[model samples]
Target chain A: MEALVASAIGLLTAVGIYMMLRLRTFPVILGLTFLSYGVNLFLFTSGRLTVNAAPIIGRTEPYADPLPQALVLTAIVISFGMTAVLMIMAIGGHLEAGHDKVNMSDTDDDTPEVQS
Target chain B: MLTAAWLVDVAASAVTGDAVTVKITHWHGLEAAALWMSLAAIGGGLMALGAYPRLRALWDATPRPEAKAIFDGIIEPLAAACRRLTDGVHNASFSRAVTVAVLAIAGAGVWAFSGGTHLAGDRALLPVTPTVLALWAVMVIAALALPFYHRDRVVALVLTGVVGLLIAPLFALFSAPDLALTQISVEVVTILLMLLALNFLPKATPVESAPGRRFGDVAVAGIAGAGIGWLAYAMMTRQPAFDPISHFHLAQSKPGAGGTNAVNTIIVDFRGYDTFGEIIVLGIAALVIFALSETLLRSPTVTRRLGAIAPVREDGDRHPMMLVVATRFLLPMAMMVGVYIYLRGHNLPGGGFVAGLVFAIAYLMQYMASGYVWSHARQRYDHHALIGWGVLVSVLAGVGAWAFGLPFLTSGFEYVNLWPLEEFELATAAIFDLGVFLCVLGAVLLALASLSRLGLRTGEDVNTRAFDINPDAAQAEEVR
Candidate 1:
């Protein structure tokens, strides 16, 4: 299970970074979302994975660390906020510059700035 | 319980300006620090407020025309020259540049892998179960393939959702039901938000990147993936170096906080400051989105694009009959579920965050099924006010603890025996959770509502359709 989770996290991070590096803003944003998921999962494993153990207190059963859970919860919500902000920025950038291309060519003379 | 009482007593004494009987320690010093911090904050706020308007008026009212022209003359040409320079630099066959970059990064990753001393003696005691491995293998493949194949944004969106759903089950398997619940609901909302945004965005990513750039991206991504994967495997196989503080939360949850759900207790009671910050971030994010959408809607350039992208209006009917009818029946039941989830959060798998999301989802359903215009006409609740009230309630709850000389968010519980019913436990945590529930609900609704408002603002006559599954059928009926 641990090995599986680790590899999953890696794969997510790789995919996330690759997408983010795409020339378009949408893909970049998608890549960011993916990266956040991988980070959250990685942070979560810091608590050490426990299967079917006690979540809350009852008898004397072991519990998965609640602190990391709380931290991940915070991260998840914060990431959502961040994603919203990024999406708006992307939309605004697209609006102002026209075309969702993240990178702009040097000379405006080469390609006329087209609106819509 | 005794420690909690002591801590509260110390805080109370400090608040009342009385000498605390507790021994002087590093922790007790925080009371003094809190006082100084508050005083300093007040001073800074007043100074900024007093100085801001005067400074703003001075800058705006007085402008040197020659200085402005001189500055623009120098800066404009310089900026253009620099742009041209950079463009020339990047114009060289980008493919060759990217291949070299990819090779360099890949070589570095290989070198690091071979030289790594961290995992030298460590090995797994037991082999991973085949089922878990298989699930992970599938997830890994999907994750890797998504970005590579993501020409269409919708397919990528769906793929992301699939990954989220897969991860949520892992959370559940790890005995973190609260996380699982929150993750799943958040996933749904996220996918919905993406879908809404995609409505205005281009259907496919424009193929503009050079092949070299794509290859470089892959190399970088591969390196990151490999590094994190190795770290995860290493950490999982070894015992933690230090004692986990989670032990304190798990042990103290029931006795000190009077809640079985340690995660809930930690969020609302033990480490409520984190929750407070989290909610504020959420509220701020929503407000920013709301503000941006309003600005974007007003901008002529964006308005033009929005006009062009107006989804094809096949039918005259804005709101479909079936969806409206279905949502009308489902709305109240969903709200009830939200309430139930919120109330039971302290002791169960549900909590304010998830419950708030549930409520927001329910409200959003109404907007989707009836269109923003219909909902606005019948019921008007200012989403801005909702967000403000939610934040205010939580902040007040935190400050309420200070009134009793207790630390912020130090919840107190009392068992009450009412006339007809059996005794029940009432914890201040519930009030705190209420604040959380409100904030989550408000933030989600307000942000999405702002997007819906943007859709309506487009000068087009298409009354925003409430969920039309088959617009062709509606068009045929109208023709008949």
Candidate 2:
């Protein structure tokens, strides 16, 4: 089970990194999503893998680590905020620049500089 | 000898405790005189040897690496390599930078892993059920398919949603009901936000990268994935290096925080400061989005571009009557559920964060069922004010602790018996949770509302009524 989860985290990370490297804003955002998943999962697993051990007292003998869980919970929400902000910036950039390319090549002088 | 005699006379005068002078007559033939003379001769001979022109010339003519040259030889190439690396990684191309960063991180991970001693942990692995395996397979396949279908933006989003949905169940299976709940609700809001932004974005991503570049990216991504996966697996299989501090939280949860849910207690009580900072960050993020969107709308270029794009929903019934009616009915029930979740959060899996998301989703439903114009017209509260007040309330809750001579955000709880109700635990954390609830609710709504403002620029017809076709109007028309 640990192997399965670890493999899943890795795969998600791989997918995220690949997507993030794409030359468009949208794919980068998607990549960030995948990356966040991998990261959140990684952090959660830092408490070690446990089953049927919710952190609520008196329900289970040994409870799962609440510390990591709390941290991951905030991370998930914060990542959402980050994604929203990134998406909006992407929209604004595409609007002003008339293109959504993530890179600006110095050799390609035809494209206008993005307004400050 | 004369100088030695003078020294002896001074010493004898001091020993006699009077001004009497004594002469040293037997200074010569002492063993110390011979030893001092031989030491002076050895020093003088070494000085003479160094002064020899032939030896000085030989030393100067011998070839050796200069200290400066040796230092430069070791440092110059290293400095140049660092320069080259930074140039490659920061060449203004996002993809290239990301690729380099991923590979570098993976390389570092491998280096660290190889440097450490490893032992297979004695901990036993859990047995995987078929249901879990199936879910995992689906999640993996969906994630893998994302990049392939990503050019088709909506398909990629659906795949992302699938992966996110699968994660919630996995959390549930792993005994993190709070996480599962949070994940599920957050997924809905995220997809909705994306869908709104998608209206302005290009439907398909252009294929621009060269085939070779893409292949290179795949290789780098694979290495990173493998490294992180192996690291996670290694850590999970092994016992923690030291005992976790969760034991302290678990033990003190009921007695110290007066909550059965250690996770909840940690968030609102034990680690309330972190939570406070988190909520403030969330509020700031929402405010930034709102501010950016407002700026974007004001820009003539953006407004013109938005106007030129075709409307997202051209010919559909803008507000489906059934969805509108159903959502209208569900709003109160959803609010009730949010209240219930918020009230029980101290002891249960539900908390302010999830409840706040629930309320946001319910309100979002109203916006979806009706139109933004209709919903905005009826909204009695300002999003900015909600955020401000939420923060103020949380600050007040924290400050309330100071009145009792307790530190900030120190929660105090008691079992209170009220009329027509059995004894129930009332905690200051609940008040703090209320602050969290309001902040989260405000932040989510504010962000989504800000994004939806873009829809207004599409020149879609603004609806004044909740639904386009009113039942009373139809009945009156039939009677006429």
**What C-alpha lDDT, on a 0 to 100 scale, does residue B111 get in candidate 1?**
87
Q: Tell me the spans in candidate 1 whose CA falls farther than 4 Å from its real position.
A: A108-112, B1-131, B313-319, B459-480
Tens-place lDDT digits, model 2, residues B38-112: 889999999978788987788899998799999999899999999998877666777767776787888888988
Q: B191-221 in candidate 1: lDDT tens per residue?
A: 7777777766666997776887677667777
Worst 10 residues of 1 chain B by lDDT: B91-100
Q: Report the poorest 10 consecutive residues by lDDT, candidate 2 chain B.
A: B21-30
True contacts kept of 2: 0.82
**Which is the leading candidate under TM-score?**
2
Query: Stretches of candidate 2 above 4 Å error?
Result: A108-116, B1-89, B470-473
Residue B242's lDDT within candidate 1 is 73
lDDT score for residue B32 of model 1: 77
Looking at model 2, residue A101 earns an lDDT score of 80
Native-referenced DockQ of model 1 = 0.45
